[model samples]
Target chain A: MFGKKRVAIVGAGVTLFRRNLKETGKELSYEAAKTALEVAGLELRDIKSVVMGSAPDAFDGVHMKGEYLADGAGAYHKPYTRVFVGGGTGVFTPLAGWWHVASGQFDTCLVVCEEKMSSCYPHPQYAFTTIFDPILERPIGMNLIWIFALEMNRYMHKHNIKKEDIALVSVKNKRNALDNPIAQLAANITVEDVLNSEIMAWPVQRLDVSPTSDGAAAVVLASEDVAKEVTDNPVWIDGVGWCIDSTHWTDRDLYYPDYVECAAKMAYKMAGIKNPPKEIDLAEPYDPFDYKELHHMEGLLLCKKGEAPKLTREGVTQRDGDLPTCPSGGLLGCGNPIAAAGLMKVCEIFWQLRGEAGKRQIPGDPRTGVAQAWGDLMQYGSVIVLRR
Target chain B: MRYYQSEAVETKDIKEGKIPTEKFRPKAKFAWSAGIAISRFLEELKNGKIIATTCSKCGRIMVPPRIYCEKCFKPADGWKYVKDTGVINTFSVSFLAADASRLKEPIVVAIINLDGASEGMGIVHRIEEYGDWREVKIGMKVKAVWKPPEERTGAITDIAYFKPIRE
Candidate 1:
């Protein structure tokens, strides 16, 4: 949508998604950022600006985490900024970098996202409790799973959907993750396995959720001229959109995500996409929870409302399916490092478009893809459209 | 860039002191002001009543009251007491606590849209199980089971939990 310089992702890099990584958050950022620069054939001196995306500071047990992670992200002498939109920070990071280059103020930008959820004592889920409203929601002693379970129950009850139907998403995504070398919780499981798994919250079993992980991902954004010089197959950022709804999530119906639809429509309009189910080759809708994939698919307008579960059941969302979704195994298959997980989706789009996603690649020659992330009490959505 | 992978560490390694680690648990605390809107709301709750702020222009009543209407962007008309009863908007049966610890008695949490509040304006609270957990369903009517007035505090917990209201 920018009339100035166009922005393109020249290279993408990510560390192995794992439950516990030996490296600190900064070290993980350095590892990912170094590889991104190396793949782009650019040095630290070439980066004009840097954008770092990290979720809550509670996860890393470090306050002012942006400044703490800045140097490692190669922002030594460059203009640096950090974006935090809860889990959507990953995709939003590159969107910020895209603007840095598209505004014609910078020729190249380095975007990195990192999350060290393992650093949170007891469990990373404990860090999530702080996200609730202190005066209203927090006093009730709620965990993160409660909200997801409540929403899942509402969605299931509304659609008359069976738990087995939702479990298939976990089965498919985990199976897909087996092909990804960096995937953490990748496994060959079935709907039965997911259904029989330990119940955390009713309707949300152990397998229904993505693992909390420590990892980092990075991508290099460059102006049109710089992109042409850096790589032969640069993935162009066609459009970016983000939206946030009311902070009082309890006041709204949980069956559908109107915020996600708003953000997707904005991005699609900017990308000149009128029919997403046909025009978009594939997609990476956020799937921290298995049912969320279906929720976001409808939000992305990839299918009719309440049709995504049916599509998943029919193998339409499979890697080999018509509208391959989350072919990188998604958050369920790939480990979910929060911010890193969202950026990982963006990186997957870059790899899939360039034919570099070895075994996880969709068979058909896919050109256009959309990566979306939802966060912050189910109120925020970030969407990015990319093309080869 | 080739053959790059992150180093994975085992939690047992850190637990067994194989990995040198520094642990610090800070007591981070804060005293939040209830402010004008919430202070009155809390006082009403202590009196076994649920109060909401009404917007004169939009005719919207907001629970967990706010001084100004979000839609109208004006001072709310005044405070109004809503019914302690509400419908279960959505709920969850949790076997874990805030610290992620397994609990002996599972907590049934729900968002209740108070009877007199505008549509979608609700407060999150715990649901007390009357009998079978299976009996709980969405759209079930519920009423606040308040603590004794002497035991009541000016907080959300003043109403112990919401139980299903039987005909």
Candidate 2:
């Protein structure tokens, strides 16, 4: 929480998100880490510490995976730690890096996140069955799609939201992803096309879901002094906070993403911002599901409750619109590689703050941005605030 | 994307995923990691015994016990054995095998909170001799059907499944 140690992102790198890559998890991590080091104009020896993240060892079919990935990420002979929060790991990785530098303990930290959802036999979607209570939830033939559809159904029923309104997010975000080089499902489509897609779950059509992907992303974070000497544009890590609500999701209200609200409050307070929509220029809220993006928008205070959907249709969330949301084409359009999706959001913020996002840049000179990821039984929210 | 224009199921090139074929590699052995005392307990059920641990600080009975009680912020050192019989807290019939693996016959996987354990301490297990999986329901009484002594393997499958108590 100290103000003077200011952690800044000097460079960022990412591998293309795809269904399958000949690369293993370590290879993916190495590819991204190499790009980040090159972009930062530094070598492996220049990094002082390391922060690694991956969603679950179950998906990679390798346990203690962070340790296994250390050498490839250039963490050998360096202070390293792994942070996990299911899907929140991607965002949590950088937050761990921020603490390493902000604590005046380390000058530079390599933040890397990798997810390989293809290793599990059969469809990797089967792995999500284990996320629920093995006793009550699992025995009922429950899968991740059911939970998402349930959330979508509840969100639609409560606010008079429609299938068409939700489809707009898929249309908007996928269209935006066309500019992202790492994007896996970037496409130009209309709401009509989305509605006609195969229905996985009643309310959740296949198009509503993010593509399962294998990918990795990394960013170089350093203290103020080190950042100033490394690059002309350093995106500062202004505030970071994460929250986890009770795992008993049935006992809580599904209409609002309360965990996200709590996480946003903690982050907003640290960033010294009282107004989110007016003050924060860009936001990359998690969009593993199209409705989730809208749900998190309200939770992140970008709009009032139930206002996110209406706001999106009004073009308020477009790149040149009032408060650009998911300008990097979120998980729905880009790709959702489990834990790596969150770090991708942080990279988007870095690119936008540095004015390096060529075709995806938000209008005007944006100074502050927020990135968030929420997952794990729909209970955890990881939020980060950035500035230049 | 691989595409087919058939109106029927085609099984070719489905990646016959019974263990990957990195082209004829030996099956490597694996071990469950630390904090698997619960896993060990499930394995021990092959001997027709149930195990649970008691927290030294809070004294709550844990089944498939936790080595550490997160509530007390310390290790749960005291351990005890529980009876294999337990009341069903909840249960369900799994109709699909995640990735379309038909169960041949759908299986009944029940979560029973064993006797003398915490309020909701239990494990999911198959229900043996239930005939139809649909017959199993919440609150049904079931007992551990242990494997024969000579055929024990120290694993969840060793318990066979939970069969209804004979009247």
List, residue by residue over A170-219, the lDDT tens digit for candidate 2: 99899999998778899999999889986565577778889888888899
* lDDT agreement of model 2 with the native: 0.79
- Second chain TM-score per prediction? 0.94, 0.74
lDDT of each: 0.90, 0.79
- Pairs that collide, model 2: none
lDDT of 2 by residue, B20-114 (tens): 33532237654444246756575566667888888867777876666777658698888788878887554444434555354455555555768
**Which regions in candidate 2 have their CA more than 4 angstroms from the true location?**
A1-4, B1-97, B100-167
lDDT of 1 by residue, B57-119 (tens): 999888879989776789998888899999998888888899889887778989898899998
User: What lDDT score goes with residue A268 in model 1?
Assistant: 89
The superposed Cα distance between candidate 1 and the true structure at residue B11, in angstroms, equals 0.4
| Best-fitting candidate, scored by DockQ | 1
TM-score for all models, in order of appearance: 0.98, 0.75
Which candidate should be chosen as best, given TM-score against the real structure?
1
DockQ of each: 0.68, 0.07
